[model samples]
Target chain A: SQKIEQNSEALNIQEGKTATLTCNYTNYSPAYLQWYRQDPGRGPVFLLLIRENEKEKRKERLKVTFDTTLKQSLFHITASQPADSATYLCALENGSARQLTFGSGTQLTVLP
Target chain B: NAGVTQTPKFRVLKTGQSMTLLCAQDMNHEYMYWYRQDPGMGLRLIHYSVGEGTTAKGEVPDGYNVSRLKKQNFLLGLESAAPSQTSVYFCASSPNGQGPEKLFFGSGTQLSVL
Candidate 1:
């Protein structure tokens, strides 16, 4: 079985700083990886997706990197603000189904 | 356009009770999924449907059943609710099942089985 692991614990950082979260997987060749931001009491919203052949993907203030060689994917938020405080999740589609296998998630708290 | 919508934003049920969560999408997505989020455990897939009338078990499908009788709707049922079934449930949809298939999610259903 493929297992996805995130930091599990919450991450705290000062405002305007960069927040980076990690996701690692075991024994699965994922076709692609995805990142989502989930606020309390709400569902996750997709942020970025990086293919197996891609190294990095970037949005306005979010960046995601997939290193298949290391079986790790990284999510970064630059110049983070307090509003960015939420749980960030990493997921994968291992040539499996429309459903994705998600990591435990890392809660981010950007304190001002 | 309501990309995806879930009914009963919050509910409280006791053991042995049964309930169903409804999910509807307007994007005409070919795939739909149900997942539960728990503290420190991340999101666990309960069940999913590839298309209308086609359902499959996910990583954790125990204690739950699903039906996709219509192309735009998916229903998740808990035949006999248990304390272990308390969690926030999410529904997501995608156009197809590939390319990290960007997902559109509903608000969610917060269920507590006491």
Candidate 2:
């Protein structure tokens, strides 16, 4: 069976520190991967996407790295703040389907 | 502009009751989707439509039915609601059903089955 897993534990980090989250999958090779941020009681918002051919993608203070060989993607937030705290989800676009399979997500709490 | 809107932000129904959740998008997207979010489960795709009048089952579609009659509106129906069917439902749309098109989502409807 195919599975996408993320750290279910909530991450607590001090403001101004970098926060790194991990996403791992098994039995699936995806062509594209995406990250989304969801706040409590609200729908998710798109953050960034990285292709299998790309080593890394960066936008503003966020960066994402995709390693097909390892079947993993890492999301990083630099100069993190309390406002940046939210549950981050990683999704994989496998095969030809436009729909993505999402991981359970990891919640990040940045304390001031 | 309201990107996507879901009616009945919150609802509570008894088991065996039937209800329909309405979703409207003003983006004129070609693809629309229905998803349910549960605790410990990120988001499970229920049903999705590639274009108007085309609906397909998704990862978890056993207790749900969906329709996309008009280009801008999509409806999700539960004929006999079950307690396990209680979840936060979200509607999303994309310009096209290909590539890395980002999905625009509605606020979501919180449904509870008693």
Candidate 3:
């Protein structure tokens, strides 16, 4: 079975600082990877997707980098704000059905 | 736009009881999935449907069953609820079962079994 590991259980950062979260996977070759944001008591919201061929992708103040060789993905939130405090999850596309295998996620808290 | 809606935002059940979670999508998506979220285990898939009348088991399908009789609706049934079954259940849909299509998730349903 494929396994996904997220860097840490929780992360605390000062507002306006850059917050980086890591996701590593094993025993699977995914065509694409996705990132999602989940607030407390809510389902996850799709944030970004990057293909295996793509090294990096960015949207607004958020950026995601995929290193297939390393089987790891890095999520970066620039100029983090208190509003950005939430859990971030990383998932890998498993098959054509697009069934995703998700990581445990990293909870981020941006202090003001 | 009511991308995806899950019925029974919250529920409490005693062991051996039964219940169903309904998921409806207005986006006319071709793929729908059910997942459970616990404290540490990420979102573990329970079951998924690729299209109408078609269903498949996912990573964590035990104690759960699913049906997709209609293209826009997916139902998850718990034959016999147990305390271990308590978790937040989420429903998601994608436009298609291919490419880089992102999933649109519904507001999760919190299930508590005692």
Best by TM-score: 2
- Reference-based lDDT, residue B97, model 2: 75
B8-50: candidate 2 lDDT, tens digit per residue = 9999999999999999999989999999999999899999999
Each candidate: chain B TM-score: 0.97, 0.98, 0.98
What lDDT would each prediction earn against the true structure?
0.91, 0.93, 0.94
Best by lDDT: 3
For each candidate in turn, the interface RMSD (Å) is: 1.4, 1.0, 0.9
lDDT of 3 by residue, B27-111 (tens): 9999999999998889999999999999999988999999999999999999999999999999999988767888899999999
Q: Is the docking of candidate 1 incorrect, acceptable, medium or high quality?
A: medium
> Clash number for model 1?
0
What residue pairs are clashing in model 2? Answer: none
Candidate with better TM-score, 2 vs 3: 2
Put down candidate 1 lDDT per residue, B11-63, tens digits, no spaces.
99999999999999999899999989888888888898999999999989999
TM-score of each: 0.96, 0.98, 0.98
> Which of candidates 1 and 2 reaches a greater DockQ?
2
Model 2: runs farther than 4 Å from truth? none
Pairs that collide in candidate 1 are: none
Error of 2 at A5 (Å): 0.5
Better of 1 and 3 by lDDT: 3
